[model samples]
Target chain A: MKKHNYSAGPCILPQEVFEKSAQAILNFNNSGLSILEISHRSKDFVAVMDEARALALELLGLEGKGYQALFLHGGASLEFLMIPYNLMKVEGKAAYLDTGTWANSAIKEAKHFGETVVVASSKAENYNHIPKGYVVPSDADYFHCTSNNTIFGTQMKEFPSLEIPMVCDMSSDIFSRTLDFSKFDLIYAGAQKNMGPAGTTLVVVKEEILGKSGRNIPNMLDYVQHIEKESMYNTPAVFPVYASLLTLQWLKNLGGIAAIEKVNEAKANLLYTEIDRNPLFKGAAVAEFRSNMNATFLLNDETHAPIFDKLWKEAGISGLPGHRSVGGYRASMYNALPLESVQVLVDVMKELESKI
Target chain B: MKKHNYSAGPCILPQEVFEKSAQAILNFNNSGLSILEISHRSKDFVAVMDEARALALELLGLEGKGYQALFLHGGASLEFLMIPYNLMKVEGKAAYLDTGTWANSAIKEAKHFGETVVVASSKAENYNHIPKGYVVPSDADYFHCTSNNTIFGTQMKEFPSLEIPMVCDMSSDIFSRTLDFSKFDLIYAGAQKNMGPAGTTLVVVKEEILGKSGRNIPNMLDYVQHIEKESMYNTPAVFPVYASLLTLQWLKNLGGIAAIEKVNEAKANLLYTEIDRNPLFKGAAVAEFRSNMNATFLLNDETHAPIFDKLWKEAGISGLPGHRSVGGYRASMYNALPLESVQVLVDVMKELESKI
Candidate 1:
């Protein structure tokens, strides 16, 4: 039975990626050795790391720009510290928009470095929408924001332009939509959502924005050192990088973000239409700021959950339960998630309405 | 042809580990979901994380000994910075034994925290032997050393008794020998050598040694935070941890380190004895401190290099070249390398002498 895995992270990837990853583990590039055993510095694996980094920049349309893409260890959580370490000056402040849980966490880590100013926050309203009219301070070292919130199913539809360096955590929505990626000085995403698996984080940083922090940054967290080493300053996450290359290759073959954006819009539209039309269900986030990658919805009455859950399980749907903080169902429609799966989920939702 | 892999660090693991890991990537535990696609918070993956952590402690005989084992990212290189951040006080010093490239790197990172004392160093001797008769400062916050030097083919046979905390970077040789594992307050190993693949790192620390640094440790670099979250403080390297679990299970089934230690010694002795008996080759490191896991050697006559390289290639050996600083050959015989592979290499060495 095929499963519609809607896991928020460490989430679904293309079937070809799983097959190729398994083959590499058994025998990498027909090299008579498992990919797991090969030296990272070897020519074969070095090519892999090189291709992964190059393809990431190519996909973002940041090629030939000042950006250097790095496949680093420690997920976006570590990036929270690295951003402050590599960007914020000694006693300087960073401006952040608090839109969701991840954005809030980033703000918390940034506060530990120096002064952190929250320009505006949607947290008081349970993060159901992207905050508007947020004024990023001009004198701040940088402005940070989360592009998509997986937990609350909200996404920033329009980013605020700033004179200061702009950084964004696109962990859930990177490569799902087309945007002028060059506008942001530093953009990072964890690989589990819409990229590959859980292990490596993709960091795209413009070279001109680094080394101005005026602090004694450690080697591992310093972006300049990683860029200098070509993401091999130390041993990188080899398997994750290889798998991500396979994914980026998959995305490129599928005609890049421009082509995938149409399909994403179709999936989101199909699911959201049912949520609004059905008397039993209602969308969780505000309609204007709803995420295309993850759709959070709640039943009008909680009593129907058992039957709805049973129907989805029978329909082979997994990871439908929302975050514990938000008690509902979340259907994550990452790039690899097919529209047919969303159709199946919509059919199940319709059936729940009919049965009730 | 079955190639004999000799790459250091990201070296060979058991064949069963490769097979099982590949199977899991395709269909994990008959769960009908690829392990790469599952959430870290899922019941299945949480079980894997628990098992891997528990088995690491169990194999090291540290169970119920106030020790906590964690799987982290950024490899041993990151642990260098983490050790200084979490152990060294704001202004106090730490003692270090400079053994090899990795140890020197650790010492470099420790210097960023406070005073770093090089108690003794074999760097003057080209790191050919572990320094002895060094005194660790009693007032230092901790003492640090590398258990085995893969690049230099040296192993510390004895560790000093310390009043302060003791930390060991056992990256290349963990789970290969039996040791008084509880003697060290903290031990970290990158999981690519004897453990599994290149993504997650294994950190085992005695609980009582933490929270004494008095520095504001970032959440990601804090061992206490990771322990409190059970290694899921952030999204862990899922595929690496699962693969490591497979390798750990294989080691346990093979009778743990005691059984593997005998085999390791036999393999090392077989190769080293032939290197000694054969006039064409000479061991690189001092006799007393030669490592059993990685045996670095050189050709006595440089003119025989072509034939020696050809013979080893014909015998299906790979990753034979030594570190660039040490121009020679290194045979890395980790826990999963079969004894028959060593026999094949020894046969090739014998063939080289006859042909010459």
Candidate 2:
């Protein structure tokens, strides 16, 4: 059966990128070696390195902006520690917007090193919306927020212009839209979601923001080490970085994030409109803070829960389950999720309505 | 033109495994979802988890030995910090046998948390051999050594008998042969060199090794946290781990370590004999300490180096350059390298002799 992938992370990718990536794994740009087996130091792979880093900057439109793009090992969870380690020298106090699990996780990791203030939390309303109107601690070194919450299906559609160094965890919605990345001092995303695969994390940091941390960070933990080595301080995950490059090229070929954003808005509106029009299902997140990436919803009756699941699975759609923290149904509409896949989910919802 | 892969780690795998890994990447096990897009928590992926872990233990022949095998995200470099964070709580010093660069790196990380003793070091002779006959520190908590030196092509043929824990950085040579694994409390290898790819690391730790260290490790950095979560602590490098599973399964189908060892030794012997017997080239390391996985050799005259490089490039043999540290030639004889390829390298050596 033909299938559509809606997994939140480690999710769907374009067929062109997969074919291109597989070829590289086999022959690596006609160099007659597997990308998996090649040294990141090799000339062929250096081109891959340069391409991956450049494409990230190109996609974000941050050339000549004093921002350095780094591809490093460890997921965003590791970055949770590193961001604090690299930036904590001036961070006597930091304001963290506790939007959901990932933001909370970041806040927890940061507090181990120094003082962190939770300015606003969405947990009171069950994280259905982005926490807003939090008093910005003007004295803090930087303010941190997650741009997109993968599980909760909430997003910070707009960021506060605090003017201080700003950090954003764009794990879910990076490359899904065009934005002024120059406004944020640092931004990172795990590759598993919108980027490429799960092995590497993409970090775009302003060079000046570094060297301010008073702590004696390990060479590996320091962003400057990777920056100096060009992310080749140690052997990198070459294949995943190559895959990221291919995906970025594809995104660029598809007219970059601006073009993708329009299509994304269409897909999200279709799904959201359908959910709002039907009584059998209800949007799990608050309307104003809804995520264009993830559409979380539930059935009118508990009896139809499994039925809805069976309906979608039979229709050749998968990975639409919601989080256990807020269990129901979650249709993750990440970048590269074809509009047809969302239509498939909407069709299932419509079919259930007819049966009722 | 035919090509051979000699780039270490993510190095090379059989063509069959690549084909299979690719199909799964497109859609996993007929589950109607790409392997990349599936949830690590889904039952479909849980089977991948069980198979890869079970195969790792089975390959080591450590069945029912009260040890748990884990597949994790970061490379062995992270383990340099993680190992001490997990096991260094005992105030007693740990013995480090410095074989090469990676070995010393681990030693540097261990010093941050507890007392460490450099029991042995081969750096005096330029890391030409694994150092031996150092007194095992009576107050030591554990003994750590790198199993195989990638750059120098030297390996520890045997481990010193000790009462304390035996920990190893087996990044370059795990599952190369059947070994007395019970001698070690923990062993970790990055997936690039001998495992599958560079995105994941394989760590096997004795279950009882935990809790002895009184240090507080960050949740992600702690081995116990991963063990408790069954290696599903977060979204894993899903495709790499899955690809590694196929490689591990491939290892088993080739009759486990014993069978592969016989073939691997044959490949290494052919290439080394050629390196020593031919006048056009000379071996880099001492014969007794040479690595079976990576064979380092040099041209008899430095003037012919570029010629030899061009000859191999035209012959479709790739990654033949030796490490800058050991400037000559290194023919990595990995498990996936066919005996025929080694013969090709020997043939080139013979041809070089005639040309010179």
Candidate 3:
């Protein structure tokens, strides 16, 4: 049976990416050598690295801009350390919004570098909604926020206009919706979500805002060093970058983020509509701040859990369970997840109501 | 034609690893889902992570010896930074042996942390030989060295006993030959060489050596944190780790390092013997320190370069060009490289001699 996979991350990618990447693994570009065995410096793999970096910038609509895209090895969690190591100055502060787990983790790492200020936090409410009306101090070296919270299924619909360089962790929602991508000085996402697989992180940084930290940075941690090397400052995650390029190419063929956003909206609406209409279910997050990429909801009565679980499992659904913090269900409909898969989950939800 | 790949790091892996990893990408474990799409936290992938970590220690013969193996990101270059952050105290110094490009790179990163002492260096000799008889300060935080220098084709044939933690960057020669695996307190290698691909790095550390640096280490750069998290401290490079696991399994099936070492010695002897006998060709690195993994050689008379290059290319040999600094040919016979490939290269060299 074809599974309706809704894994939050390392999640569903386009089927074509799987087939093509697998083929490359067997024999890359008809080179008679597996992609796994080829030197990253080979003309073939260098072309792959170049195209992947370019395609990522192109998909985000940042082409020809000062923003440079890098496919680095460590995931977004490493970016948490690099961001501070590259941006925060000696005794200088950085402002961060505590939205959820990832956002809070970023803050914890930043504190080790210098003064880290949490401008606002939705944590007190169990991160059920986006915190509003918070002030980001103008003196901050950078303002950081998580664009979407995967664990809580909450996303920031509006970003604050900040004088400082704005950095956002778009790990779960990048390339899902069309936004003013140029507004932020730095944006990063782990490839495991909407981009590709789990080996690389996509970092798009505005070159001008860097090298002002006035602190001596390690070569690997410095953005300038990576940018100068064209993301090949060291050995890159070649397979993941190639797979990400394939995903980005798939998105481009699907008319880019603009076209995909419409389908995503439809999927989110269908699941949220079912959640609201059925008395057996209720949405986990506040409606206004709910993430289109991941819809978190719960059964109104605990007793319906067994039937709902069985129905989804029998329906060939996988990865529909929510995070432990929000004990319910999370239907992650990433870029590659078909609308038909969302329909199947809704049907399962409705069937439970009828049986009751 | 099946080209014999001799590219250095990100070089050839076992053919079975390529096939199995490719299949996993399409559909993992008969689970009706791509390995690229499944959650790292999922039962299947977690098992992969567990087995990969266990297998690394098992292959190194470090199992049950207080060593914790971790698969990390950012390659050995990142370890250049992390080692200083985790092992070098704020006021203390560390000792390093500068052998070649990579060893010098390690020294540069360590200097950023604290006082870095070069115990020995062959840079003056263009790194054609490994430095020996260097004294390591007992008061230093740790003693660092590159076990094998890929760029210069030199390797440390012997290691000195140190009271301090002994850290070695075995990125190129790991698992290719058997050594006293318990000698080093920490061993790190980028998976691109003998292990797997370019995305993940394998770190094996003795538990007692960590957590004594006393610096406020960033969570990502801290080895103790990674060990505690069992290498899933963040989203690990899943594909690279899986592919590495496949390569390690292949090694074990072939009777592990003990069995592979005999083959490696045989392969090295075959090529080096030919280089010494052939009047037209001369070995680049010193015979005593020449690496078994990578053998650098040059044409004795530059006039025959085109013919020799053409001969190798015609024989379905690729990645035979030595690094620019060396200006010759480097036949990297990593573990996955078949002896037949080396025989082909030797035949080509003999063919050049006959043609000349």
Top candidate (lDDT): 1
Candidate 3 chain A: worst-modelled 10 consecutive residues by lDDT: A33-42
Docking class of 3: high
Q: lDDT of each model, Cα atoms only?
A: 0.94, 0.84, 0.93
Q: Which residue runs does candidate 3 get wrong by more than 4 Å?
A: none
Which tens-of-lDDT digit does each residue in A1-356 have in candidate 2?
76777787888887777777767666677766667777777788888888889889988999889999999888899888888878865548777999999999999888877889899998888899997678888878788899998888988888888867999999899999778899999999999888887778999999999988787676677899889999887778777788888888989999999999998999999999999998898989999989999888887687988778889989988788888877888888888888988898899999988887
lDDT for each residue of candidate 2 in B109-195, tens digit (9 for 90 to 100): 788767878888988888888876788876677889998999899988988888878899998889897789988889999988667
Interface RMSD of 2: 1.8
The CA lDDT at A32 in model 3 is 91
TM-score for each candidate, following the candidate numbering: 0.99, 0.96, 0.99
Query: After TM-score superposition, what is the CA distance of residue A240 in candidate 3 from its true location, in Å?
Result: 0.5
**Isolated chain B TM-score per model:** 0.99, 0.98, 0.99
Write candidate 3's Cα lDDT for B1-356 as tens digits.
Answer: 87999898789889899999999999999999999999999999999999999999999999999999999999999999999899999898999999999989999999999999999989889999987788999999999999998988988889998789999999999998989989999999999999988899999999998888889999988998898898999999999999999999999999999999999999999999999999999999999999999999999999999999999999999999999989899999999999999999999999999999
Off by over 4 Å in 2: B90-92
True lDDT of residue B81, candidate 3 = 91
lDDT tens digits, residue span A12-128, model 1? 999999999999999999999999999999999999999988988998999999999999999999999999999999989999999999999899899889999999999988999
How many clashes (backbone N, Cα, C below 3 Å) per candidate?
A: 0, 9, 1
Screening candidate 3 with a backbone cut-off below 3 angstroms (N, C-alpha, C), the clashing residue pairs are: B10-B192
Worst 10 residues of 1 chain A by lDDT: A322-331
